[model samples]
Target chain A: MADASSTAKYEALHNGIEPPSFKLPLIDNPEIVTANTLKLVEQTPDARKRFLFTTLTRYLHDFIKETKPTTEEWHGTLKFLSRAGQLSTPDRQEMELILDIFGAEALIDTINNPPKDSVTERALLGPFFTEHTHDVSNGDSIASEGKGEYMYVDGRVVDTEGKPIANAVVDAWEADDTGHYDLQYDNGVPDCRGRLRTDAEGKFNFRAIVPIAYPLLSDGPLGELLLAMNRHNMRPSHLHIIVDAPGYEKLVTQFYPSEDKWIDSDSVLGVKKSLVVDLEQVNDVESAKALGFQHPERGFKLFKRDIVMRRKVDA
Target chain B: MADASSTAKYEALHNGIEPPSFKLPLIDNPEIVTANTLKLVEQTPDARKRFLFTTLTRYLHDFIKETKPTTEEWHGTLKFLSRAGQLSTPDRQEMELILDIFGAEALIDTINNPPKDSVTERALLGPFFTEHTHDVSNGDSIASEGKGEYMYVDGRVVDTEGKPIANAVVDAWEADDTGHYDLQYDNGVPDCRGRLRTDAEGKFNFRAIVPIAYPLLSDGPLGELLLAMNRHNMRPSHLHIIVDAPGYEKLVTQFYPSEDKWIDSDSVLGVKKSLVVDLEQVNDVESAKALGFQHPERGFKLFKRDIVMRRKVDA
Candidate 1:
């Protein structure tokens, strides 16, 4: 049996701030409600926050007025948000997933990291990227044997002027043939993901499985949202890569295989025309043996491209 | 130790919807991303959802473009929403609280339930209403003794033409002197609330404690939001009531006492000018004795108001 004091703990407590000295008209109508809200928002101490909140309030109010969502519809939106939050865990960011599918994450990325004509275009730093990567020498396999069909990725890190950037660190990861990242598996060891550095000629290479198109998590609200919108949830097959050097702007990007079916509608809206590349089929036994494939007779797909980086000062 | 099959459960699963047949241009720029999103939203099967989502997407995109929040700022917003969701429980609706403070809920109510020229205006149906209420006869006490200073309330339910409505059900509830709902306490029994039917003359009376202005829940993200905006979280003291009868539009409302200090700046934006009323002091001993007070000489505050409900046809 709990006492009154036990329930008293949930009672309202003042936040210590006093009411505003300015007069607020009684909020009898929707317009007055919006007016009073904006006035209160003016009290925000930080200028940036004040501006952001004001803009948000105005736009959100305008949306409500224009759409006139019924009480039921508005409640639906709130419930959707709550369910998304409940489904999210540290390893699975359901909120970011929602933003991604809505193209909000892409918009934010575009606004914050606008393109430089000569530098490699940016893409979403998706939720799958991890710092716990295996360090492999150039040409070593990132995936262990029998993971998937073999693929070789070799690229050169160059400046905007096409000068080789020696010793630039390169990081790469991809989904295996089953369309799942290494982190999705119970095995703790990293696979189909690795880190390597460019050699003297700014050349870097790694052995990995051919990346496969993957679906966004469809067992949650996000999937239901996609179903409601009548849209698919597949991202095109792509290889994730990051190039970093001290004096240069870090390039976070992905190379979508041109032949993949879902290239144009990449679910997260992460596909850029310039970032799409072709993977050439190489069946030469000599080439396979030289690249350290355990089975030289079995040919592999080859992807070759050059990464152009801009100077940090230019960025 | 978890096996590979156990970990596989978290892998992405498709929602079974095929990709749309329409061509989506490569989403290399922000404008293209918005264009593609709007196109995809056109596929919604429901007309209302289509309009609402389309309007929401446009406004949301415009807001993003206008504010151009940096990556950190956008992430902060997402984190704030996530925390609000995580903190919410069945007992406390933090999301609705956020909506209330932001004036979204008020705006929605106003839009959905417009006021009639001659009828009583509607107010927010706050999160505190419960179906479990004690049945009290007219002129009986609703609150247990010692909850707060005594108050007497009598009201009549009438039509738009000012005719008495017999047997109209009137439901009333309020916070105790401590500014806490009976449900907020761990004690399972209900207090400071009741349900009663109007007499043949449409008149109903009951005794309750003097409702106190209460603060919204603090010690959570909502509290932090208020502090950041330099705003207080208090709602003006008021009594919640609902009047319902066959053929009459249900009237959900609250009467704000003009003497409460927080009347002008209700944190929930729930106050309206017409709903404010004066609580007259009645110091007559005869009235206290007639009202069945244990200490007849103490006297009590008096509140009198007539509720006018619109017909369902008019509504």
Candidate 2:
């Protein structure tokens, strides 16, 4: 009865017995598909999500129309996506790396959290971030046995006005001298990784070896894709850091060594000019004595950097 | 020494003592990233793949810029994609369905293979396609055990000129009365699925239960998405068919019951005007007996549709 009534309504409208309602007619094939897709997205009560799906559908359709990938290419893309999902783990984020490779991650971050003002530039959190970093007192060594060349890192947490922010939690991690991260090795405890809190004066310090530049993990489909695309897989030596303090926004970033060979060729494309720190090399004996190192005769480089934080929950 | 020499060359250029070499200036950040990405793809000797990746990066970046999805929204999309990939199995093509949902698959197919020249309209193979179908003799029933209302189908494979194409292989599949596809249940073997070859006159016949209108597998994220979007998940009653001949292009398509309530609202957007068949009910006992049905008085619907094929390898 309902179908008949609707049919009659359409017939009446066609025969000029009734006015045609102002409704979109389902005609064009692609348009019909878009209408159907949007029909589902329209039900989203969350305004943000609704907008996101709308844009996703539009751009996805646009991409397909523009690319016109063959059936085989389409199927192969699906297969590659499946492999990427399967390659991910709790510790390894293959899909995240894919986003970095595509430059979406950095672009999205820039969109959501624009970098300006006096705050430290936010870089990629990357796939290897593990909060398992054990906190130590200031000037403590995060370097596990047999890591990179000894390096001293002294930094301060501050507001836009450069006011020292005391008690900020500074977590840090980096790959070893061989360019392999701690998780890449058999040892459960992370090597060349540690955390420390800001002192009353807002200054914090930790000792670790210099990070080594290395290539990304290319054994998976992403790696194979990069290789096929003729892109380098290397990242410059850097230290990942996350700073958290009450009443301030969380800061996730990394600082690169200015002298690293791959500094200009970082594979993940997460580099920023301000984030690169110039290491100051000091005499071995003088440096060890000043920093109270057990091996006073063995000198290490020093890096000093200051970080600024936004207010908590700042958009 | 190499670094020193390069620095000296730059210094000489800066001092106006040497001509600057023709080099790609890395100005734009995103462009630099793209250039680096292209650098790797350039290593591939395969020209087609190189072209594909080049377009992929362009469109991907364009999408990000146009949509400006928030960090959370981007992450959510990645999660949804990962789930879609993980949800797939040998019998189910979840990603393919996702493509259909986004209308990319249909749009791409249309763009690549335009509909014209009397060729059969293409339809999605859908996740339920099974090559496990048994080859049956002509006029044999494909309905297994107890199922939906019985129907007789006779079809002919012909060229655009209407001449019969003998020995053409006809494959057919559909869901049962309960709206459950063969792959959806525990049945090791499928019902309502079979293939036959054209006779001397290019005619083929089969008996099967009428497929009922059914919703797609909405237990997955796709279902949740549709429900959220306030769209019906149902697809109209249809029969999936594939016709193949030695010198003809393989045709994968479906015929929709014109009377089906959801015929015009197929969730997959796969229905076409030429593919809708009007099933004719025949209570004629004499005709049933002629068709070799044991119970002639128990009437059955009859459908006769002809399929036209294009030459194999035609562009």
Candidate 3:
């Protein structure tokens, strides 16, 4: 039987009286703690979510056990995590960068969206992709102004069987000559990023400045972590692309210029040998004119890649 | 030769013309991501800190690989963690609660402070402990006024030899009759909790209200988590104690009243079979008068325990 006090407490609860809430008592025993904590994850109906929490809960307990952090160290970690969360915004995904530094993004991508046979290797879509990018027609210059080595890119979206997929959405973005994305600058909109619909032949084209390799954030906690790690934060120059079409898998990838030295040690590990393109330069007047170039002598670097998407399977 | 733009970017970085900072790029490959991330924990002169970060980084990546959460799920987890951190205050230690729910606290305690052959088993001191509790004399009422069932506790603290150790400090605290600590109530100082000095015979006494079993917080993320787990948040009724003396290890522990059904299911996992004790009710008027009781025949419950401390090996 419940004690008289317990009965009174229940009555108070039923009568709309909520007492102040406090933290649970310390179990002080690790074995029971893990067992009891694992028992706390049951009623969630969503299988995927439940699985995620269970795994995460296990990992967290194990990490703590292995580390055995002192109270000071524990507080330090909590502070760092707190700063990471507080620093995040809709546009600024600092937490994602934290995951990158932890190498979580790459692992998750490999696990959830692995490449299939004869399919192009996928890369991280990254935090910079803005939803509803400005729509454009083929051959439109996504660049806001003349800068660096002129880059000309034309690609096609096709099924794995090589059949042209018209009406496909081809989205592309890259950094400017200064090794910065449009969002990183005061210019606001990503001048070198846009979307285009594939033509009747499944072809899409975008003209912009070739991107320059650059380092990651150098003034934040992530940067501090990199400094602590003694690792260079540089990434190779590349163009990011995403192609979505009816009945096909949404492809997210990036293509690095082969000549960039950082390509081999791309900080974010975003490169696959198949995704690296060897750009061709043509100073010949005829070749430049065919590409609608205003100056043949100042030949632009041509980057070409045909995206082959796989059929989407129902989850 | 480096491209002119590449040269310019390098020059800008070297010349302190640092551009704006943003999140790092996604590495895309788990192997390289892990390698690159492992290379990030440097500049820390503290060896323990270096070890901590290196292990944490590995575990984080491994956990992600083992559980490839979808973007939405990952974000949801991040948000939950963020909220936990944001909700923490000097008084409200939500992060600690999160740790408790995850079972980290128990594991850490076990790993860092192992049980010696003859020393008392340790329990977490918990955040509710107030430094410099009001000192009480033997047979004094630690309770300020009538609350719940009257409780009388007397204990002795000694080394493994079982010899009386004079001048030992015995600190004690317990929940009120309603399962609320003085800190949880608006009545101010924990009139139910205090510390006392052992007399020449290593004996101490404190009179207070019997502690009531209570539940963990059921209002925040941890509470929601408990709900999801479908587990009752109740903790068994117990009294927390700490005994310290010169040349002996401090002993921190709790004693659960055997009558409480939740003893085996203490939410904090703090209850051990050895820590359970039965309280005796003395209903005789003469016995009540002998113990300075205000009521005859309606005697209070009496609790008794002897604390065994080990010789301190080091400072």
Candidate 4:
């Protein structure tokens, strides 16, 4: 009855009824079977699935060929997108974070950026990459909150030929006294994160804040995927680094603190054997002062290291 | 400065802050990495995909454990989910459609739904399951509107045992003169959709409609994925059916109207050789009336079919 009335009304309005505006556009295409799906051609794997994927893939292309978004749906998509920007902070690059968690970040970088020839593996741009580093001296403390371990770290940046790459920027940052990134400190002291440029001889050093293993944020769709995997989210002690040179491919990598247990199990597959370094203690005051420490007698740990990179042209 | 003020306020008003309130419970029995993931493990033809599947499954678990959502985020997720339901229609099961395009629906139905012993392959629940079909004589006409070839289709539904399955329902619906489903016929006249029950002797008949080939909806995320995969979305001429019996598993299948130009290339991979039936014309009236048609010379076609099903225990 409703159909009949609606038909009559439509006829009265327009000389003839027309298709509802929502119908999909017409398309014609062929199906291609791939090695990945050939075995499921019959029996156990279920042939319908193979056919469905093959057919649906074509349908999807046609849809894209004729993309149509309603004004309201388009606006809703835009509005939802705006919230992603609002959610970002120094400790929270929610947009990039979302991409990372969903695997798109890894996929795009892997496909388009393939670790430039011989540069150190490029890690993800995590939420904590701020512009400046606190200028702590050779033995100055970074654990101002007075919590966590009290160890030291040191390293150098170099090129493929093992020569020290002078003046390379070796910015570093990490969670602080309470295992929370500076921006997440929410309490205002962005003291836990910092950066440092390597010296003329390609050496860089810092003191205070022995790093401890900590878990990733335990919330959101990403968190849910991780928990379902039964894997631990703890990251081993590590120092973030961004090495850049005018004519060399830049490298963003991390040095895992040797004692932290999760180095071998970094969830994002960020840890590498060459990126692990040891922090040894030195009780010599004169030696500390030579390294620019005000407290010569103050105990300090030392990290000595070098990094290699491929020439930019080759990369 | 703001940090200092907030610190002072915190000390004066609430003493030192306690630990953060958002701690996630860690697992006591963490899963041991029993096997190296980089090596060949599953020997199946799709070993690579299988490995990826397992790896992602585990990773998702871990992600969930670490990212426990705050109450607000949880509520936001709920609200986001409600939109999926609001988007559904009789012609389109949005959620099921998503599941189909994502392979989740087939995976769930194929691997999870049926008992281990069934021989019939489980297929996906398509978007066009809404239209109600009706009973029409073999020589009857179904051309209410739109355009296509004038075809007279005849076929039988049989079980593995080859016995007739009496009174099985053969509900059918398809596109009219235009390549659109009844749901897409929002303008008027619920034309090309109907339901028809078979006679006690496993015989059923219908007339009038000869459907044109059509394209599936190609807009949305599913469409985008298809574009990335490079495929099209066209279904060949076919009759939809839902064959049911008291003790047998319900069969929702389609029979191709023999000779679709692209029968071999249905994007959805739904063309089965066994399901194709030829359409014949009957110019004689006595033979048409013997089969119970009111007219003969007026140019009607005769179609005879039997439906068969497997016995309860065997089925």
Model 3: residues with Cα > 4 Å off, grouped in runs: A1-75, A131-135, A186-190, A218-221, A246-249, A264-268, A281-298, A311-315, B1-72, B131-133, B244-253, B272-274, B293-297, B310-315
Candidates 1 and 4, the one with greater lDDT: 1
Candidates ranked, most accurate by TM-score first: 1, 2, 3, 4
Ranking by lDDT, best first? 1, 2, 3, 4
Which tens-of-lDDT digit does each residue in B122-144 have in candidate 3? Answer: 76676678774678888887776
Q: Which stretches of candidate 1 lie over 4 Å from their true place?
A: A1-9, A294-298, A313-315, B1-9, B294-298, B313-315
* CA shift of A283, model 4, Å: 7.2
Residues B44-99 of candidate 1 have per-residue lDDT tens digits of: 89888888777878988899999998988887878877777777777677876887
Report the number of clashing residue pairs per model. 0, 7, 11, 50
Writing each residue's lDDT as its tens digit, candidate 1 over A86-197 gives: 7777766787778777788888788777777678987766778999999999989998887788889988999999999999999999988888888888666788899999
Local distance difference test, each candidate: 0.85, 0.72, 0.70, 0.48
* Distance from true location, Cα of A58 in model 2, Å: 2.5
- TM-scores of the candidates are 0.94, 0.84, 0.79, 0.60
Per-model fnat list: 0.74, 0.26, 0.31, 0.01
Q: Which ten residues in a row have the lowest lDDT in candidate 1 chain A?
A: A1-10
Cα lDDT of model 2 overall?
Answer: 0.72
Model 2, backbone clash pairs (residues 3+ apart or across chains), number? 7
Q: Which residue pairs show backbone clashes in model 2?
A: A40-B229, A229-B40, A229-B41, A230-B40, A230-B41, A231-B40, A284-A299
lDDT (10s digit) by residue, model 2, range B127-219: 678888889989898886467787899888899888999999898999777776666655456678998999989898998877887766666
**Model 3, docking class:** acceptable
